[model samples]
Target: MKTVAFYRIGMIICTSSILLLLISSLIYNLLPDNDIPQMLLLRDDNGRIIGDAPFAPSWQFPFGTDREGYDIGYKLLEGAVYTIGAAIIISLLSFIVAFGIGIIGGFSKFRVKSFAHKFFTSFYFIPQSIIAYNILYPVIWEPMEGFTTTLSERIVIEVLVLAIITVPTTAILISNETEQILGEEFITSATVLGGSPLFIFYKHVLPHLKMRLFIIYPKIVIQMLLIIAHLGFFTLYFGGTDVCYTPFCHPPKPFIQEWSGMMGTSYKELGLSWWIFMGPLLCFTVTTLLLNGIVKCIEGLIDHEPYKSKQTSRENETHSFESHSKQEKFLFIKN
Candidate 1:
């Protein structure tokens, strides 16, 4: 009961937060202009940049100003859209690839599964950050084409990178789960009854696999988000354009307004204003918590054994009652 209550609380919080984020993303994407908040613009005497420009946080500006005089709040909100969007794209792509490969490998003949396992083994040890960095090299060296592309292209890049990074681990995990299920008595009986391998695997095995995958989805999303955050901290993200003062871009610009990008830019300016760093840091922390909460919720949802057992017990009671009724009627008829 305690565990179930905890999960319920977590689910409510995570769902609310994610919904807020999605709404904010929709608003930001729809907005025509991406101007720095008026409060963050350079101020003239009397806290005005030229004549009427404002300075610092007030009702007009909630998060104050950055070193560049940009509204920290606006930027932070915009950043959330990119970070969340990227994470979603990556998570979905990774799941699709991992699910396909895992199912195939899990149900394959022994020889095929062995070869697939060996193929994935080499990638199992690669560090995610290193893999993300290596993947970024092409984007960095090529003409900056990612920025001019549509929103879908930007999402595609994130998804591809995340899928590549996450596939091996997810594949291994799902394959292991499937392998265990394949060893069950029902699976053996199905095989003995001349059930086709594919049909048995799909009809019998995948029902259980679906529940396991739901439980795993949140974990995979968290891992992919972490990887993207690390890459963003290094300024290797896509869709962001940085003004170049140097002949060549030194620290690569972030692709979009991202939590890591905000952190990358503002962590050093912590002395300027705690709000600058605190806002993004808080966001990152909360997002991590949200992901963990979501995982717990998913686990709770899939943990049907408790419910199933109760259901079975009820059915047994009903069956026993009916049996007793029939016996009483038989005795009455005999009398």
Candidate 2:
């Protein structure tokens, strides 16, 4: 087998993720957070959708503007903040729920484990974005009197929905892993030695499972972010809201900048201003790739023997072949 060095691979992936993270941070820091809505509404002399004046890429406006006079550069940065932030929050929440449920359910009494299994299985089957829109809509979003509604409640709903969806999966993953660990020889030995279940789990199992947890973590985050992006594609907003703020109500949407929302807003003009689409698209792609790389690295590191053993086998084969050649020469000389 072609063996890969897990440590080296992890280092490369970590470096890449860091680079993307830095770029995302820089993109967010340079842009004005408050004036984002107004920037998107920028127009030209003819009332066209041109972001800032002159529509040029400069130190001030690195991304240029759009047909609607919106500053593409600033918009991209703001969108990055939203999408990336949302993904992170969603991922973190999901992981927690997943870990909590999975660990408890997996290790719980039979009745509790059974209930958890059925409940999360149902949740796992349901599309998270749909749940985000359907189950939590009424509880989260509040309709406004006059113009478009705000996003506060809806964002909450979105997070809740995402958390729910993630919890089930996370629980399943963690539980399965925990179960396997609990069945291991060391775990069994500790239990036989009068170690408390909790103590063994926390001290022995959890410590050993750290690498596996790392492998699963990025995947969970990636899954949630993908769902968020899909919702953005549908142009689903909190209730009747358009953007984060409507100059009246402040919805939970303002709490985080969503790349999906930015992409949704500019979806129609994607052909005209590819940058509008490209900016968010690129950000999502890079983030996804980075997360994926991290997961692979973790898995590689944890399961180093898979590839390393192959290299060893090949070396052994070569050594054996050399030994056989030397034996033949010695036999011929003796003959």
Candidate with the greatest TM-score versus the true structure: 1
lDDT of 2 by residue, 1-335 (tens): 13456566665866566557657766667756646533445566999975444344556566666555566656666556556666677778878777777777667778667776777678667777786666654544334543332455556656667776677767787888888877776566556555676766666667656667778877877887677777666656423333343667533332244567666666765666566666677777877888787877666665664434345434533554565456653334553
Off by over 4 Å in 1: 1-6, 40-62, 122-124, 141-155, 240-252, 303-335
TM-score of each model, paired residue for residue? 0.76, 0.69
lDDT of 1 at 27: 91
Once all C-alphas are superposed, what RMSD does model 2 give against the true structure? 12.5
Candidate 2 segments exceeding 4 Å error? 1-64, 139-157, 238-240, 243-257, 270-272, 305-335
Q: Which ten residues in a row have the lowest lDDT in candidate 2?
A: 236-245
lDDT of 1 by residue, 180-282 (tens): 9888876675666556777666556776677678778878877877776677667655554353555765554555677777777666666756777777787
Compared with the true structure, all predictions reach lDDT values of 0.70, 0.63
Clashes of each: 8, 21
